[model samples]
Target: MKRKLCVAPSFNCDDDMEELNVAALSSRKESVAPLTAERDGTLFRHSLSYPLALVLRLRVLQIVCGISTLVMGSVAFIEERQKFNMGLGIPAGGFSILAAAVSIHTSRGWSLVTGGASVGAGAAGVLWIASGCLLIALIVQSCRTILDPSGLDNGDGEAIEDYRPSPRDLIVIACVQIVLAASTLFSAVVCARIDCTA
Candidate 1:
């Protein structure tokens, strides 16, 4: 989507002109304070551009981490299923995949709700917090699943060696899950705090 950025025009400004412009801008914001509640489009109100880039970078990282989580979990789950006699029940890998999908959807759909036109704050808050908690749980589950030097995992440390899945994939999943959880939670907090309605 094309964001309508508020850009200050460049002009050869004398000291007096700059002071007048600053005063005018402050007065303008004071007038619109009731409508915006002092909330700016960017997450950081102090600066116009710095945190915007940081926010975007963090969001992109969150998306990448989610995708990697899905791919690694799927690969490990498939390989482990073939190697073991597990039932049709969903495992941590399955939950990881599910959470990855949720993370992707929430992160992508986040921009849509910034205008407060698509969804309400209450509903969005619930979804964001839910997804954050889900990812945190996944991190815990992934951490529990570790393998020794024998190249054998006990299926997220739940069962014995015979039931465990891929050990190598677990490492990748754990690392990616950690990154995903952190990035996602931070992004959600920013979303809840910012008011893009301006």
Candidate 2:
């Protein structure tokens, strides 16, 4: 009877050991699952920072370009109306001013409101790209005007006079437009990358 009791106790102990091993394996799986999920979440969230940074950089450059254009346009309008290329200056200055304003608002996390509706990030990005394209076209036009020898003369049969865009001024305008174009292009690329990732 004592030998029978000892054998029964040994069988119970083997059962308990198997149960413990199963429990440990389940616990390990649960722990590893959460850890991998957390890592994946962090990676996805942080992956956007690179493109976002570029967008912000583009905004900053837009702001600077806007300010410069506004100032230059104001000066041309006030002091050099006769010599200023109104066709080029007006559009470039106007675009810059608008771009700066919108970029500033967007950078501050404000959404565009139309008919009491707010725009989404995707829509905003699309609008930004479109604006960038128009700005590039303006920049190209301005560059051509600067490079063309007969760009400064008024079309109403005006004689050559002291009031003319100096070579230095033309060069400066060309350079600024070039920089603006480059910045806009870079931002467009970043924005495109964001779209692709999405």
Where does the lowest 10-residue lDDT sum fall in candidate 2? Answer: 108-117
Candidate 2 C-alpha error for residue 48, in Å:
5.8
Q: List per-prediction Cα lDDT, in the order shown.
A: 0.50, 0.54
Predicted model with the maximum lDDT: 2
- What TM-score should be assigned to candidate 1? 0.43
Candidate 2, residues 1-198, lDDT tens digits: the string is 455444444458788999999999999999899888776423333443334445556666666665565555455444444454423444554564565455444442222121223334445555565556656665676677566634555777663676555556655655665565556556556545654564
Each model's number of backbone clashes?
2, 0
Cα deviation of 27, candidate 2, in Å: 35
lDDT by residue (1-198, candidate 1, tens digit) is 999989987776597798999999999988998868756664522335323444455556555555555555555456556432111112323343344344333442343434323324455445455556566666665555443412353567554656555567656645665565556556555643443421
Off by over 4 Å in 1: 1-54, 82-118, 147-164, 190-198
